[model samples]
Target: MDAPDTAPGTPQAESLEVLYQSPGLPRWRLPPALAALYGSDLGFTEPCLYANFVASLDGVVALGPEYRHSGSTISGREPADRFTMGLLRACADAVVIGAGTLRASPRHHWTPQHVHPSGAADFAELRRRRGRAADPELVVVTARGALPADHPALQTGALVITTATVAAHLRSSLPASCTILAAGQGPALSMREVLDAVHNRGHRVLLTEGGPYLVGQFIAGGLLDELFLTTAPVLAGRIDAARPGLIAGQEFLPALRHPASLASVRRHASYLFLRYQFHRSITDASDILP
Candidate 1:
């Protein structure tokens, strides 16, 4: 990392500037234009569980329940960030999200082309080279089975992982394209079971944009391998506990602290694109959950 910015008259509106990168990162073949815009190629190891998020400088990932789609507000819809999102999606075998996230963005589609239309052809080419499908499958994790049946992402098709009790109801309510995977019989499903189910479906490289609560469960279970965080140039003030940070619904600061190494860093003006690698500790999700 720590490379200079691209020269003027590039195809993209903005290009990422490489600030720092650790040695020996896994990289896949990227389209020339995509690599140029990203300042580098990107890839992940097989059977990887990674997350992507855009947070404010003060580390507020969600504004509040009142604010719908706050991530766009946090990033101001930066072109570089969008392109990075598309790139990540293109590299994943499946894009995972929580039910709340699916409900919050009713019109959103979890695909590479949806986020960055300019890179559609490039992303498709990259996926073709990787022998991936035209689009990554969408996976929605929910225990309560509270989802918008008419959501476009659902109509397009998704894997709804939920409790056994809820799966029956969703099968009748959700669209035919949506596949239901009954994980367990409880108010909450274990993250390990969810990943195992995804793995059984032949999705080795998984990307999650499932908001803070679901991500907290992943971290609590030591299931997350890498985190791609975008530090947008803004501070979201918190008046109450309604606003959540990058991790919520679980605390791990005093007794159990999870450390991560900075894998890479890139920048687009004031926005900082940071990648961190975390080591998995617990063998099973039951180790963390009671």
Candidate 2:
């Protein structure tokens, strides 16, 4: 079904231009509701993990305390970016995010309909066709279990992947609707365990919308497979020590320079959408094994 342009001032999807795509990348038109925003289908297979993020031209993902959500600030609540996010969520089995990301957007719901209300029915139909749940399961990862229990997203129910110690602390704090998974015994949570827990729950197509630190852990553990980044045209210059880039709390400079190959590129106006697939060497693959 085609999603009409019901929202005023929202950019149409037909405006998007495909610049480049890898040789073997699958290509197909999206459903009518999403076709305007996303021209091609993102035919992701099961047991895959991908991350999505938006940053400014100055490589700043967060604008410190001055801006509530650096992404919204950087993208200026661009309709194309939101549509892309919604489209990704629509194609995923589950939506994952760090606790920091949950706290950052108090009113945000990590669902396709929340971002693109016009495509709500279309998203539902897509989920039905894929044999997925009506809404993608929300998975929140926290090492310390420090989360806003009363947040609307938690109220709707979520799987809290955390450490055993933190899980006990959160048992009574979080609503009964929220299920806590003790992915680790110690004070820290393991990225591998988190993926295992999600995979065990039958969510093989995982999409992580991170807060940098979580993305860094996924990269550090060599668990990340692909990265879908939206480069906003604005330049959010860093004026303080708090502004962060795409990856935080981890360095991959000299020892772990993870290499990735460009998979696809698209553009809408001044915004650029890029997809990079991480190239995992045999050595890196063995390092992540149990």
lDDT at 91, model 2: 82
Give TM-scores for every candidate, taking all chains together and pairing residue i with residue i.
0.93, 0.91
| Per-residue lDDT over 150-226 for candidate 2, one digit per residue giving the tens place of the 0 to 100 score | 98889999999988888998999999999999988877777888999999999988889877778888888888888
Candidate 1, position 229, lDDT: 94
Per model, state how many residue pairs clash. 1, 2
Top model by TM-score, which number?
1
Q: How far is candidate 2 from the true structure (C-alpha RMSD, Å)?
A: 4.2
Candidate 1: list runs displaced more than 4 Å. Answer: 1-12, 282-290
